[model samples]
Target: MEDEHEAIDRLSTRIDEKLSSFSTVSLPMCFKVPNLLRQTNEKAYEPQIISIGPYHHGKDHLKGMEAHKIFYLNRLLQRRGETGVRKYVMALKVKEEKIRECYAEPLDHNIDGDALVEMMLLDGCFIIEIIREYQTWNLGELQERNGNFRNFNVESVVCDLLLVENQLPFFVLSELFHMTPEPNQENDEHEATDHLSIWIDHEKLSSFSTVSSSGCSIFRVPNLLRQTNEKAYEPHIISIGPYHHGKDHLKGMEVHKMHYLKRLLQRRGETSAHRYLMALKDEEKKIRECYAEPLNPKFDGDALAKMMILDGCFIIELIRENQTETQKIDVDFRNFNRFSLKRDLLLVENQLPFFVLTKLFQMTGGPNQENVQGFIPLALLFFSRVMPGYGNGLVIRDQNIKNLLGLVLDSWVPSLKARDNYRKISKEYGGWNFKYSATELHEAGIKFKKIDHEKIVIKPEIDEAGNEVIKMGNEKSFFDIKFENDVLWIPTIKMYAYTDSILRNFIVHEQCHNNDTRYVTDYVTFMDCLINTSKDVELLRHSGIIVNNGLGDDEVVATVFNKLCDSIVFSKKSFYSEIFIKVKGYREKKWNLWMANLKHNYFNTPWALISVLAAVSLLILAAVQTIYSHLSYYKR
Candidate 1:
């Protein structure tokens, strides 16, 4: 007991010592130079004396000015009438997370938050002093203290301050700037901000620009996306659109595509494909523009019209065959690997516009049958089997359906609320986060629970006298994640062979598609960040968050998620940001960390728990023996 108490005392003293050293340089608040600055002043923007923000920070040539920044900071503190560094640091420290988020890249975690906040304080004050003294070179204190301020080329420093790399966040500087009093200097500060805002707002405005549908929503998969799992994007049994229209490896499915198209004409009681051909020619330009990339130059208007008509008719007929057994085509879609075709249809590169398929369906269908249901619901009916949630009431009206991948995504998101929560980009640049794998979080006292995949159903019913009734079943979305009371409730994900491919393509679509809604990407990225290795995979598997359905070992599942995010850009502010902040708060409590260590190191293992019990029994026996000896001595 004496040894343990002494060790704790030493630790407490060490922590106090570290806290006293908080006023030092640390993390950078930086982003790339905005293109607006590059275009107008490309040749003229380099930091002459020192870097202000994170962009040009840590350059070898700029190290000499570090002493000068401190030199200016010291003078500013005296002028502001501040006694110590604690108050300024405390002020900025309260906003440390928000301050770090104002930059584009994620900051390194090596520096403690207190130290980073201290750096901001130093930089903010340094800017005010250097700029103030640059114009009025007769700083009475500086003239007396040192010759360094006199040696500085004030004009060069002023020009350097205007560069985008030299730009500090306005709010950060403003917080420190207003702490001190200066006669008529508010006008000068406002003027300087006005100039910076002209460049700052230019970039901000572009990021928040209104999202609109560019008729060309379908994109050719970039090589960066294909690196994860190449076969997933490539159609094994068939090709659908212009991007994969004529690859030799996919030629076997060509005969099957034509057979289905011929069967469709037979069902329509038409001997000629002339009407479909003419219809396709009329809409060739529209169809051509629907693909984001240009078609093969060899495919002029006639070739494109033929390909569009054939591909469009093939998909309509294929879905028709899948949707109904009664309206059967003579060719056997059942004998082939139907799963391969379904997987191929979900690929981002292999897609036809919903309109093209709709047009072909309307032309080929009997008016009575076609009028019964719109193309959107019919399409959803087929894809719902693969994705599993669109048949529910949450799907919006489908006039806006872009393609197959979009339809599949609509099915994945369970509710309008989940969609809105993900799409809500914060106006404040404040969603920077830390990645904590499943094992790491488990050791930090977070409990993981698998959300029941049952649909929570409620109904108002008259039962004998009259009462309301509620019901539920096993059917919920994988994206409905909840975190509360240090318990994370996530829906179980079933991993199949096609799971990796489909997820990668979905991520790519979200990256390139319109409306800035990357709900699918965000969810996958969150899961990837949690599963760092097979150990994390095993922890999550035991908790029922990940279910491997014959997808090799746990390591394979872990590798799938870890590599899924390669070369993919993630939004700085995302759906899980608040959850991350809450989890950090929970883990930061010292009691939680100590308790977690105790529970994991002792109670979780049988031999360790037994050893702990033995040690505790010895301590209790020693105390009782000492008490008896004292009582006997007193009685005597």
Candidate 2:
């Protein structure tokens, strides 16, 4: 053991070091919105026009306003009669460590200590200048003094300043706010303390010119179609595009919209966000035309650009984060639900134009990258669960994907050989003429075999003899159905709570648009033909062709497919025309239909079946007796 005094001195020094470290260690005032809550609405927590703190400081779109911060800092210095930035820099440096420690995560990843102090000085002063303007109500004089019209939106800036992610520590702000030579007005100090309350005192924010538009690529679900199932068409977690932009229940995801914009800028550094803003501005006419509903008058070009960029970036990030998981987003399991976000993305009404999403996605590509991955594959991966093909590892050959739903429709397409029967539209594709339910087909000595989608099979090339491609054998989409050799090969269709909604949305999308081939509709119509009653549902369910996931009972599945096509008045179907013809051929022979009817109807009653059995037994005994009598005569 050491001497007492020596130990005491060592202990004292350790205590001092610990005190210094702990004293400077600031509690986290700024936190990343939890991924679960962030998923709700992405835009509400993000800073759009200006980013005040390090979390959003380096974003390209928000970066354009940096010069304005310098300008405002100069204005602050001039108004306070200070000729130099020395004192302001010196003041912020003292509290830099504590200021940085206020964030939930380490700030070193975003900025160095010196740079952090400078940001604090600039942001603090910028906020002060905006408040000062409000205090004096001399925006015109200030504009005149600057000799340049303010290029940024004050209202949006103020709104950004108030964002949780954009906030600086209050002590840092308060200390910087009180640094100025105090003017005679007591209100100036009070305003500085309450600087976050700054908002443009105007009724309307005119950031861009207004324009009118019509004829939309994104349309609302018609009541006729939506009436089948309203929740399927509506977004539960988040909204996309202009139609469901600001619904209160779905508002929680806006922060994530803003967060990913920040994340996007961090990952791929481009020039000023003004580049994207101006690009979107030029697209105003097209955007207006794409939405079936008129652009809200309140949504000018600038406002629209801000909303779109946030939403677009948010969407891209959502897909990216969910890219690695199986059937769900990679999440902090405590917060994010196990179910996918595809429910919202797949809706017909809840869509951003594929072009808009592609535009932002392509433009945001990292400059150093040699080859950028196409958006189609990433989108396909995110929606693999709902897509008929699983959409994973398969080569996507189509480039004409119009939107998310359209991508899924493309994925549902069977191989060329599988589609040989459905390539051309048959006059009877949409007609309800020759049909046999699953039960009826089973009774006709036509074997009902479920195609296991989990195995792998090679679909031979239509043109090339030796060329073939591997496809889902056990795990396949519902669209691949075949009738051959007295057997019907139907792929499994996993029914979930959302399956009805997913298929309904797909059907309605086809019903609304004039698709040359209604792939989803034809598939649903084929299923409707196969499942006429609860008995048919039972047959399919028993064959492992219909896997129920949380959806209750066979009767519900029966009612679902039974009523699928009832709401559609005008629909053209072609994908399953060949399969329909083959099934018709099997049932067309009089013997098949008569025997199927006999097995289905006659054997179904107890007494009648017993009577038939008794009659058949008596006939067999009489035939045996005649054979014995003939044998006896031959022996004599």
Candidate 3:
């Protein structure tokens, strides 16, 4: 009997311990910027203007925004008339515990339940009011409260509100929002009561929900490269997603976003905004899950919905205006260069969910009110300006392209089946072991030729052994190379100032988001092998395979490629394994080696060719004279 009692006690204790462990393991939506990534570029991860969530909540510099929060909260209450603040506080009280659970870290003991509720109330009201003000442009009341509010930079505030560390749970804001008065339905009890029950249902629904692993396509830049080149991942002129929300340096671009936003409203009509907002609200939960991190506490369904609508509209409009020559001719393109905007849009951190863009484009009736082809085509057109052949021969519909950078990478990389074949080839042919430079290959009689990108096609074939094979067909692409007649025919690749940034981000994307194919990394590795010095760069340049726009000197280009190669962790399998084997086989041939030496010695230039022919003629005459002298001696 004692043994049975002890066993029961032990089982109970184990159950209690497991429950305790589960309670402590909260789902973290937002994470404290990793120490390694932060150490490299502290500015990229740190909030500059205002703090949104608990992480940077009580910082001294960010306290200035506290006054604005209170002001917005007062405005919200005033719009509600009597007992508004009390009702908001009461609603948030019920959500205080739920809100605390959303963050990965535990709340400080000093910030009791009351303090937490009040923070939620104030921050929630501020975000809702700010978004409302942006939509309505009603600065009259704000000016009356404080003249400086009229001059406040909306861009900086909008950016700050979206940071990962600066977010509030959507439920808390949704709860508080129910207490606020609704326009045109002030007397409708059902409208106000409807939201209260909806919030509860959302709470219950969210608790039981599990985000699928494949759902989140967005990813932070890999820590390895982020530590070394944060600027490469960061947006210089504009903030897109929650990651690099509000920096002072990026304020100039905020005005442009605003201009684009206003233009969008003017062009699409104000009703279009409402339609897009509704569409985003419907997909808010899925959109939030798409982000790798949980949104900041400030982003309730309403606030996030508003942001998606505005940002999506701005992007769609920007693409539309840029494409129409009449619009382009009227606007001063010099101030807002398409190339600069393209760079900003392609940054890994600066991206919206492609779905949001697609939804907005569809809601706006698309170009000509037809199917939603405008978004992808316009996006491709924009990127192709910066990266030649980016959209050429690409079926955008065939890809699960997540963002601008993803689209750019999809255009350049081979298909999944092709990548698998390449991996198999690499494994079968002694792995990715080739490391000869361009100059070395040239010396080994491997002549270099430029392939025309227009005529190339990538075709899949079945080998004699019944194995499926894929080859870089006649399809000419940026990195396509073919070996024929002891020559390596490589397509021309243009290297500009922004090439490093584009390549690095694409590599980082592959490192973080993609697991199967490392096409960009493999391409970089192959380039590194081919380019060891300025002579290699010169050789490629002479072959018309490299179009150096603003990459400075050949030494600089060599250093760039070398450093890029050093940073990435290359896979054992490579996309160019078959080509490497062919080059190696050609180099091993004695006849080819002899022909290379003979060419280098005697046929390097026109003058050298003429001198070699003269020498051969003299040798023939001397041999004939010697033969005649021998014959005369024999006769005597």
Candidate 4:
């Protein structure tokens, strides 16, 4: 029994050592920030000097926080000389006033003060004040072991001071010093006696950048200020949208607006235009930079971009890749003078399909410059979506829109309309009428028409003994697949038809009886790459054919799928090994179908047809022989 207890102790010690090692490697940088700040303070502490926060929580918590070691805080404060210490003192004073204001009570000032101090401690502001007060006072008496308090601000202090500060006080008081120190602990402390302090001097905090006075500092939204050096309401960055506009639209534009606009575009030759993207921290500086001529026609490239935004969805846009060279550069402004708004501005309504189309356009390239003016809104929407700090997800929820999108993607790629001798052809395809509109279908409650199979017939019932006493013969074959009540019931296949592509693939590729479905994903992806990319699908002809061994129960799911393939085809050994290691589960299944088609297709090999013909001929010969033998027997 003694040995068992000893072994348990040994095991616990090993576990604790392992846990400490793991924490060092796995903890993130954020976990070290608070500690770093504490260390900065520790380096500034003098051996006899002690600092405390005006706030209760700060004093109470930091009184023994692992980061509160005197040597570290003092070291940090030393670098800034006395200036850093003074600044910390001022900040702490400000925090103290804030704490007092929060805990103000009219009656029984002592109770109010006590409650307020404890409240501040609970709020974390108290700790900040304590650290500030401790640093400013440099009270050496507070550093003594079993240090006695000179004064009590509230009820009896529920804390004890220790000469050493290496870990959070809670842990030390509760675990290490809850009772008299063990013999080993006493020996360890005797050999180690060091005092130090450190401080990290940061630049003065600005009012706008400091944590909000309202305790809700973490969640407050940032306020963007306009720059006085530049013009108000005019951003330093200008993004021209994909929508086209005539050059005449640019004629009456405000000259002042143009100046700011040009500056924003950086066409004036300075790289400062990009500064608009900076956060609110440098809003004023960014504006001043824009004053240096932002945009110039000569150097500034045409701002052609398509942008879209939803009330809730993030903004989306399409910026043209580059200017394409055409033989004739036509500059026609005769009928292009209208100031039309971007399609996205009209609101969602029944506009899902059109919205999707605009998104695709934005994904492609920006509009041509014949319509650069009168496109600021579109440009703004586009930039809002593609801008570095913005996040948006485009989703088409309307059924009509989804169907129309499917058709459009299936039919033709989006492109610009070109003038021809014949009347101009609308670049838009699919969703030509309200029938294909997303709103129209949704209002009508249209749904996909599912094809139904013939009803299944019931079979004769059998008893548990397997004895058919009653003569029941008529029955229907239970081999047809059925989709009933939103459930895919495949009686023949004995598998559910999962609508989700991934789930279905998992079921097929991983869960199927033969693992026959597993290879489909790979095959599909391969086929798509081959066929869509102009590569000949026939190239797969050399690949081994995947034949489903009719034995469903004996089929391999995936582990042996490749082995079976090699068994039948006998391909290169290295190719087999490479495939097994590279592909785990596949995303494409069409490639498998493509491979099967390639192997079976008569176009690839005339020999297949020849083989079929030979088999038919042999069957015919056997029939003739059988008929001849029967006739001879009858004559005998």
Can you tell me which runs of candidate 1 are displaced by over 4 Å? Answer: 1-214, 325-331, 368-373, 388-393, 419-432, 454-476, 599-610, 624-636
For model 2, the local distance difference test gives 0.66
Cand. 1 Cα-lDDT: 0.66
Q: What digit string (tens of lDDT, one per residue) describes model 1 on residues 1-636?
A: 999999999999999888776534344445566688778977467775566766666675555455556555555645654324554555676787777767666655554575466457657777877656646653333332334433233444556778766777788888887765464332222232332233323432222221112356787665445545677678877788888878897887778777877888788788888888888888876777687665789888788877777788887776776667543444556556665677888899899887777778888887643631345445555555454222222433346668877876765654556556555733322433556778878888899998765443322233354432211121346677778898988887878777787788888777665334456767778888788889899999999888787677899999988888775656545666666677777876898778767877887679989999999999999999999999999999
TM, every model: 0.60, 0.58, 0.58, 0.19
lDDT by residue for model 3 over 1-636, one digit each (tens)?
999999999999999999998888666675677788789987666665567767887875566456556556655644654323445555677766667778888776777876677677768877777666656553333322332232233444566667667888877667666656455335322232434333422442233234333356666654435656667777766677666666787666666666767776676666345666677889987788777556788888888887776667667777776677555564534566566667777877677888788777776754563445445556655566577332233344513767667766766665445454565666434544676788767877778888665533433445577644333343335655567778887767788877878888777777556345466787788888899899899999888888899879999889878877544545444667778788888876898678767776878689999999999999999999999999999999
Give the lDDT of residue 429 in candidate 4.
Answer: 18
Error of model 2, residue 527, in angstroms: 0.6
Cα lDDT for residue 374, model 1?
47
Between prediction 1 and prediction 4, the one with superior TM-score is 1
Top candidate on TM-score is 1
Report the lDDT tens digits of candidate 2 across residue range 317-370.
Answer: 666666555325333233434344577788888887777787887787655221
> What are the clash counts of all predictions, listed in order?
2, 23, 14, 81
RMSD of each: 20.8, 23.6, 19.7, 28.3
Identify the superior model by lDDT, candidate 1 or candidate 4: 1
After superposing candidate 3 on the true structure, give the runs of residues whose Cα lies further than 4 Å from its correct spot: 1-214, 330-333, 366-370, 388-394, 415-432, 455-475, 591-636
